[model samples]
Each structure stands twice: as C-alpha cells, then as structure tokens.
Target: MTRGYIEGLLSSFPKLMIEGQQHTTVETDAVRYVYQPLFEDMYAVLITTKNSNIVQDMDTLQLVANAIPEICQFGSQDDIVENALQLLSVFDEIVSLGHRENIDMAKLKAIIAMDSHEEKIQDIIEKNKEKEAKLELKRKAKMFEMQRKNAAKAGITGAFPSTGGIGSMGDAFGSKNSSNFAEPEQSTYNNEYSPKPTTSAPATRGMQLGRKTKGAEMLTSLNDQVVHVSTDEHISVVVNRDGGLENMEIKGDLSLIISEDDKNATSIRIACLQDDSIQYKTHPNIDKNQFNESGILTLKNQTRTFPLNQPVGVLKWRFVGQSEDSIPLSINCWPSATGDGSCEVNIEYELNSVHMTLQNVIISIPVESGAQPVVGDIDGSYDFNRSTNTLDWQISVIDRNHKTGSMDFVINTENLNSFFPVSVGFDSSTSYCQVQVLEAISENQSVEFSSSSKITPDQYYVI
Candidate 1:
C-alpha cells in the first residue's frame, strides 16, 4: 500500500535529501522517493512503490512544487501550517485515489475562486433596499421636525396628536413623496386653501369653502361640511440639462360629494378648453357617451341618483406632452467650475403659462456635504440646509407681475454634476386644461353648488 511506502520514506527522508540539490529520485528496497526543494529548507516529496514509473512521479512532483508557492504567500513553516487545509485540498484535487487528475493552473485557480452572477445581483438589490429605507426614515424625521417648528410658531403649547400613518402626515401637509429626491424640509404651499373665483355667481347653498380634513378623525368630525365639488390636478415633468423634454404628464380628476337632500342632482356640467392631445375617461357608473359629446357627468340610469354623503370620482383626464412648451415652468441650470476647488451655479426659472400663477415655488439644488453656499444675487429668499445638503430657492408667487427669477451662488465643490438634477415643487390656481364646473342640473333646474380647482407638482425635476 502507499501508506506503508510513505511511512518508510519519511524515516529515511533526512538521509536522502541534499542541501543544494534541486530534485532527486532515490530508490530503496521497497519504495522510491521523489522530491524537489520548495524554498531554502522546505521540500515537497512524493513516496511511491519501487515498481512505479520514475518519469511520471517526477512530473507529478514538479506540479506539486509549482502549486505550493501559489497556495502559500511565503514558503515558510508558518505559512505551511496556516494553509495546511488548503494545501490538502489542492493535493486531493491533483491526485484522486492515487491517480493524477488532468488539470492545469488556470482551471485549478478558477475552481478555487467560486463566483456567482445571481449572488452579486441579489447583493446589489439588498443594498438598494437598505438605501431606500434609510431615506424614508430621514424624510419622516424631517417632517416631524418641521411640524414641531410650525406648531411652535403658531403658539400651540398642547402636545401634538398621533399621526394616523407616515403617509397621512404628507397628505395632511399637501405634499407628495418624491421618488428621486428628498422631501422639502419646510412646509409646502397650503393646497387646501382654494383661490377665490374670478367671476361672480349666485350664492351657493350647502357649500363649505376653505375647509380641509386633516385625518380620518377630522373627516368624521366635519361630516356636515363634506358636500362640495373639488378638482385635483397633478403635473409631472422631466427635462434634460441641455434643453429637451424627457417626459411630461398631466392628470386631472373630478370628485363630487353630495348631501342626502341634494341626491336629486342629475348631472354636473363642466366646461373645459378643448384639446386634441387630451384623453378622457369616465367612471364606469357614469354615462361615457354624454361626457364625450358634452362634458356632463351623470349616471347611466336616470332613476338612480348620485351617492349621498360619499365622495365619488366622476371624470379623469390624462395628457402626455411631447413638446417642451407644454411645461408650465421651465428651469435652466448652469454650473461652471472655477480654477479653485469651487463651482459657480446659476439657476434661472421662467413661467411659461399665459394665465396661471404659480405659488410657493421651491427649487432644491444639491450641494456637497458640509459645504455652505454663498449667495451673490437672488430674486427671492434662499436657505441652505446643512443637514440635507441642499440650497432651496423660494419664490412666493410667479404671475404676470413677476414671471422670471434667477439665483446665483457659489459652493466649494469641483464636481459640476453635484449641483444638477434640481427638484421643483409649486402650486397653481388654474388647471392646465382649464376645466371648470359650470353648474349642477337637477330636474332641468340649475342647482347651487360650489367648485374648487387646485394644481400640484407630482414629480418635477431637471437633470
């Protein structure tokens, strides 16, 4: 057996090895010893039966000699002890059941270094999830801090009520969660406050104005004041840095809440500027044909009345704009690096809407961490938040009186891209499609109803 031959060769290995010899093959009465010097004093020896082929044993010994240096950093006794298990695995790979395996250095190394593509992808996904969770936590904390400050400013000493959920806080404050950027630190424009109607009409009945429900409890408390007509419009715009529209989307929804006494209200007539680019969809329960021909929202069955004391969505419209002119506001950002490790950023905004006035416009520009921006010239107020590392430029209102604004600031950063992909949030008093509710008709009589329209930015950014 090979075990007996190995034991005999180990006993006589000291006498057989020479000091400066590179390799040797010695034969005893029963076994043969084939070994080559590894380093100064280490030797990789192979013991075989006397009848075994010396040429093949020498070739195998050469392989063992080459692999030792690849496995161990230094061919010292300490390295050999530390990598004993790995060396054993390599030896087993080279010779299985006393028969040599046909493997080269490239294949051997590849086998040792096991890599999986799926594992790498999973790791990347886990990292992204972790990043999103952290961002959400930061947003919640910022919202709570802003709420606390606003409460203090309003002279409220009582403890704040528990927010129903994380999302409820943003909804209560008239802010939507942005996917690509952090939430604004300050309170956004009050979306609940409806603008005064431009034209005068007869006094409306059973209508409550400037009243917004905070949460589920608030809604339950103000049940009597829930009868109203409201329109919500969300605009999302994405633009490239140079000049082009990446994407532009406009969505509008009409909601109605009627009191029990006004259940007889047959149809709600709406007037809107006709546009071929707009697509309209009515609720399944409403008459789609009538809405397509004339903007009248009514049920299919004449006998059945509208739902009482419950909110119902009647009409929805969507518009996808391919041209840049469709954007209500256009923002241009220019960042240039100075000779010093700093950058000068100039941002300009222009109102493209002919009649609509934008309010509470906040443009958030990213900056380097722990870097302060020196504002040279700004049309409106500006604030640099160190915690979030962003410089926010705020304009109260942008109408015909003030349709353009600019901001210039300098920060200690050489990266021009750091100041890019600006996030914008604003409120508009008019809808993009100019859709307006004219009157509610019941039994061929004009019904007194109140209507309000509001526009909010869903996702507006420049990259």
Candidate 2:
C-alpha cells in the first residue's frame, strides 16, 4: 500500500488516533495495515498481503509488538535507539527470512541473555590471573612456615613432629598468626584476610562493599560477615554446617521455638543429604510444618510447642528458593592443562555470607575408577579413599567474616568425568528467634534455633 493511502485513512480517524484507540486496521486494495500508536510522534505499522488471514496476521503482529517492551522495558525512541542491534535480532527471530516464524517469548529472552561467550571467557581469564597471584603468595608463606617449623623442631622440646601425616595441619587450623573470624567490634580494611561480601549473590551494578544501599530492605554490615538481616523482624540467621553434621544424635531437652504471632516460618531446611530424612524422629506433641511443593517446610499460624526430651531431625527437603538462592558455602573448580602432557585442577572454595559459623568444613572430590591426584601446600588436611576413588578435605573450622582457601592438584584427565560437582559438608549452631515489637505488641521470647542448607552443583557449570 502507498503512504498516501494510509495517510488518507489516518486523516479520517485522527480523532480516534488522538484518543489512543489501539488495534485500528485500515484496508486498502493491495494490502491491509494494522497500526498501534507507540509514542507521541511515532507508531508501529504492520502491513500484510491482501491474501493473508486478518485475525492470524494481526495476532502475530501484536506478539511482535509485545516483545518490544520486554526488550526495551519502556516506550521511548531512546529505548529503540539504544537496543538497535538487539531489536534487529529480535525482528529476525520473529520473522525468519521475511516470513513470520515462531514467536516464543522464552526463546527470545534466552537469546538476549546469552551475550558474547568471548567476553565471559575473557572475564574468567582475568579472575584466574588474580587467583594465581594469591596462590604464589601462599607458596611463599608455606615455605616460611616450613622453615620456622624445622628450626623449632631442633630448639623446642614438645613441638609437633615435621614428619607427621600433615606437615603443618595444626598451623592451618587454629593459629594466632593465621587469619581467623573477626569479632563484631573488630574490622579489617583492604587486606587479603578481610572478609569479602557475598560473591555468590545476584550480580548488580555499582554495588560497593560495606556501603549502605538505597531503599534496601535491610542495612548490611560494612564489616560483619556473620548474618544478613532484613526488615522482616530484624531476623538475624545462620544455618550451621559443622563437622558435616552427619549421623548425629541429639539428646537435649526438646523445645520447638515460635516467632511473631503475625508471622510464621516459611522455610526449615537441614543441609544434610535429602534422602537422610528417613532417620528423623520428633515428638508427637510437636506441631511441625510439612514440606511445600518446592520442598520447604511451610509453617503457618502456630505457637510454641510443649518441651520434651531427646529430639532428632535429619536434613531433608529441597529448599523453597532453590533456584534463586545461592549456597552459603561453595566450591569452584577449573580443569586446565600444563604445557607438558600433565593436566592440573585449580580449586577454590569458601564460606558464603550468612549468620552462622561452620565448623569442620570439608569437601569431597571424586576421581575416576583409578587415578591418583598429587596435591601439596597444606591449606587443609586431605585424606584419599581408594575404595571410593575420592579425596576428602578437612578444615577444622570456618568462622564468620573470613577469607577463602585455594589449592591446585595435578591429575590424569582420564581419571575424571567431563565434570562433576564437588560436595561440601559442615556443622553449625543456631541463630535464636528473638524479635521485639515496638508498640503494645506481644512480648519477645528467645528460643534456640538451628538450621542448615546444602547445594548440589551449587551453581551449575561445565568443565
């Protein structure tokens, strides 16, 4: 259709146009045009052949128009101009080879999110370089410690032997010279030992560490790494994962705690394996919440339970926010090769930002049916089990607001699968339920609270 043809029809419907009456179609001899006014001075016009089915054609046109907002988020010429390249791709996907094809919303989003693998690979390179520098420093420290230990072995009467299975395992676990968790009043600035903020949280722009965020639900600590609090009752929480908290026996006085009468517990997760719940035993007087569809134990409209003795609850149930939430503790593994035929695996793992402290933090890595990994530099103690083709790492304790540990292993590529998630386990105590209302609200009560969570494949990735 000619511009004059549409202009003539548009002139007659100028009143309707000004009133924003969308979905107006003007038919002409050669083609039909459906117009949707976008902004003050611009519009989207979808022209179709006269032979095309009007309803189907118009619906497809609407779908294409709807997806524009998903891309630009607002209706402005600036939005269109800024996303020119991406919109151009969207147009192609909506109409393949100048013919309308699939109009799948999810597919379009996935396409946009998957931006420039080369850029991501470059980022990984930059991060790995920083990690390698830290590894070198660790090597120098190890050498210094070994020398000090040798000297002490001669002069000191009861010093640990140098030939023990762990050359300096005691030094790694609990040493005054080493960096440990900071007290609430204590702080560190711009040092390797400083506790970094949550690296696994959702990525954001212009987020500086320890700065107060505008309109945040809760003000995070510029220093403390123990717990994160929000507006929901000043609730400070940490789920412990000490000593892997496995196959434990609890013989304490049983008391189930409750919170505000206006609120209820939405999640109850034990970080042990999901299958281990079969071993759980609770009292008949307990008013326990059952698991939701997503596996969180959803509790509502309940008060404190009567006290009993001897209670046991094994870790079970998938987390309610499993897809969105990150692991409080995690592992990162990268497989690479040396110039020679030998291959190496670089691994870094640490505690995430949360309220609880994890004691006896450990990691388990599986090897192929028959392969030995040679790893030195004792940041933590390691034990190999030939029967299971696995290596177990034991760190005595990982306290709140602490730095991470890294190490390298030379392994045979044939001894491993393409990739597998490293499993981590720990034990921890509870953050009690003690909240107070300002007004003539209910009085606060303190009850012991213990919880934990584990993520398998924490964040999924390929080798």
Candidate 3:
C-alpha cells in the first residue's frame, strides 16, 4: 500500500472503534485494520487483506500484543519508541510473509538471548597468553641487567675472547684462561716452591702463586657456551687443648657443570700431581682405564652423551693427615683464669704457606652471653655480637706481609672450654689437589674452554 493510504486508515481507527471495546477492527472494500488498545493511548496493530483468515489474523495480533509488553516496559509511547527496532524484530519472528509462524514464547525468548559458551572460553585463553608474554619479557630483561653488571665489575670491556683452542702454554697462559688454574707443567711447582714443613705448623693450603684470578669474568662472558669445572674441598681439622693436632681429614671432588645448549660432547684431559697420601675414585659411568692410563675423563659408552644442564661429579680424592705439618693455618689458644670470675684469652694464627694468600678469613669464637670482649693487640677487625655471643675476627687478606698475627681479649668466664672449638673459614684461588685441565677434546679437536680452582676450609676448628 502507499504511505497516504496507510496513514488515512490509521487515522480512521478512532472513528470506527467503540468506546468500551477491548479489540478494534475496521473493514473496507479491499482490506481490514486490526488493532488492540495498549497502555496510555498506544496500540499493537496489524494490517491484512479482507480475503485473509480473520481468525489467524486475530491470533497473530494477540501474539504481537503479548510480545509488546515483554519487549517494552510500561507500554507507554516513549517506551514503544525506544524499543521500536526490537519490537519489529519480534514481529518478524511472529509472522512470516503475511502468515502466522508456529513459535511459542519460550522459543522466541531463547532466540533473542544469543549467548555462546565457547566464545567466553576463547577470550579467557587469549588474555592469559598476553599475560605470560609480558612476564617472560620481564625475566629476560632482569637477566641481561645482571650480566651487564658482572661484566663491568670484572673489568671486561671488549667482546669475549675468541673460542679458539689453546696453541702453546706460553701463548695461552694468562690471556685466554682468566681463572688462574696452573698450567700442566706448573701443577707440581707448588711442592717444589714451598716444601712441607717438618715442625708442627700448617702446610701449604694450595698452589695459588700468582696474582688474584678473575674466574667470574670468563664464566660471565661465555655464559652458555662453556662448561664449568669446579673443585670443592671439605676439610675437617680437630686440635687438642694443648694446641696439638688430634685428627685431620680432607675430601675433595672435581665436578663438571654443562650447559643445555652446549652440544659438543667432550673428553677432558687433566694433569694431576699424584700424592701417595691421597686416594682417587672415579664415577661409575666414566672410563676407568682411560683415566688411569692417559688421565682423560670420558664416558664409558662411546654412544652415550653427558647429561645437560647438571653438575656431574667425575672424580673424588681424599686425604687423611695425622700430622700438624700438613695444616695450612695453625691456631693456638691459651686461657689463664684470674681469681675473679673472668679470664684472659690469647689467640694467634700463623700462615705456614709462603706462596699462597688467603682472602676473607673469618674466625668465629664463642663468648659468654651478654659479655663484651675487651680486645687488645688484634691484627684485624673484630665485631662482638652480644645477641649470639660471637666474636668474629675478620682478616681481609693474609699474605707474606701479614702472615703471623695475634688477638688477645678478656671475657667474663673462667671456663676456657666455652671459647674452644673456634671455627675458621677462608678462600684461596687454588685447589688442594693440583689437578689442572690441559684441554677439552671434542670430535678429535680441541674445544675452547675455561677453568677455575679454589680451596676453602669446610669445617676447620680447634676444640
């Protein structure tokens, strides 16, 4: 129909309807207008041809009237105008091509809700992926910053050293190997340089004869490209009340820490200064025959590879010294009680090794609770902590110049055994067992590598 005809028909609705009627119908020669009164002068209406089924039209109009209240609140003119598009959509679902559709209210409401469970799950997964990506970026940034700081502290300015194999001892002595692991020839130089003393004094701790080594620089520079060689020594020394060695035991191990990204399967050649007093043991997976004959550490199976990103203990050596002459540093403590409830303690440490230097030496002596030590003639600094009742003697560096030093302190205790069992801790750039890495052979070729050796007193005390 034209717009003017539809408007004229809508305008004629009031004149044709009775005042008390609940439903209204207007008939003309060609068509009929059927409508129901809504709230506040609004109506739900439908137009159809006069020849159409009046009963079905009336049913469709009743459905449309029922749906208008569900779609628009209050059924006011403003509410109907606000939900005009929604009402039209509902009307389309009710009637199709001028015919009523076979649909109920529950099915129509379900179609209008339009909810999907899978879409919500996909959105959550996408958000989580974005969060994980941000966390990974932060972790990498922190790692890079730490590496930069370590490189600067070690005075490493340029790029890392070339990953070329060592050619000669003289050429690659101090430049390539930043950690001062002795050369193969110099492995026995410690015994020749400083002989073991015959007196009841400590022997040489290790063979650190040169300047301090910067082993951290090599490890930091090579990062994941190089394997790490470490020697950890656990020493336990017990001295009697008369400053005599009661028992001494030393245990050490050589461990290899490989990186996950390093795929070069290598066999390490080593130069060991064999001592009759020490016993050696190899790992079960190692080739014992090859290690005994040529001092090469390799896997027993030729086809098997070393486990990546883990520390593997390849060799272990043990030494049991019953003499005080083998001790690196000797401590003598003498306590004299006064008539009062206090005593004066005299403690002295002598470094017997003339060739090696010890760093960060700390001697811990227990004192009575709430008692302050009056220190005198101390060679180094001392800190008295009353909470733990510990007097810590800190010696920064002990070399030839400051080898022999003494510390005297007075405390309120006549029991000398309270100050007994003084523990000592130190670090040296040397290993008790002078085993040096000669080279690392991979695929019948020498692979570039670095080595670090250190000696530390795990449990050295005098009781």
Q: Pick the candidate with the highest lDDT.
A: 1
Compose the digit string of candidate 1's lDDT tens values, residues 1-463: 5789557669798886665442366777877887655666566788888888654565466557657777886667999999999999988877888877765443455445432222322233233344555666677667776887789789885656546666666544443344433422321212221223224322223444675422222233323332457787888788888999988998899877664344434588898868889988887777899988988888776765554433457788998988888898999999998989888999999988767888888898866555679999999999875434568899999987798999999888777877755778787768888888887787787766666678877567787
The models' CA-based lDDT, in order, is: 0.69, 0.43, 0.65
TM-score of 2: 0.29
**Superior candidate under lDDT, 2 versus 3:** 3
Question: How would you order the candidates by TM-score, starting with the best?
Answer: 1, 3, 2
Candidate 2 per-residue lDDT, tens place, 6-27, comes to 6875565444343523235666
**Residue 199 miss distance in model 3 (angstroms):** 51
lDDT: worst 10-residue window of model 3: 181-190
Candidate 3: which stretches are off by over 4 Å?
Answer: 1-224, 260-263, 338-341, 353-356
* Distance from true location, Cα of 293 in model 2, Å: 26
Pairs in clash, predicted candidate 3: 202-327, 203-327
Q: Which candidate, 1 or 2, would have the higher lDDT against the true structure?
A: 1
* Candidate 2 ranges with C-alpha deviation above 4 Å: 1-319, 322-325, 414-419, 431-463
> What are the per-residue Cα lDDT tens digits for candidate 3 across 201-312?
2121344666442332443523534566767666667666575787787788887655433443578888876878888888877789999999998877766566433345
Off by over 4 Å in 1: 1-227
| TM-score of candidate 3 relative to the true fold | 0.50
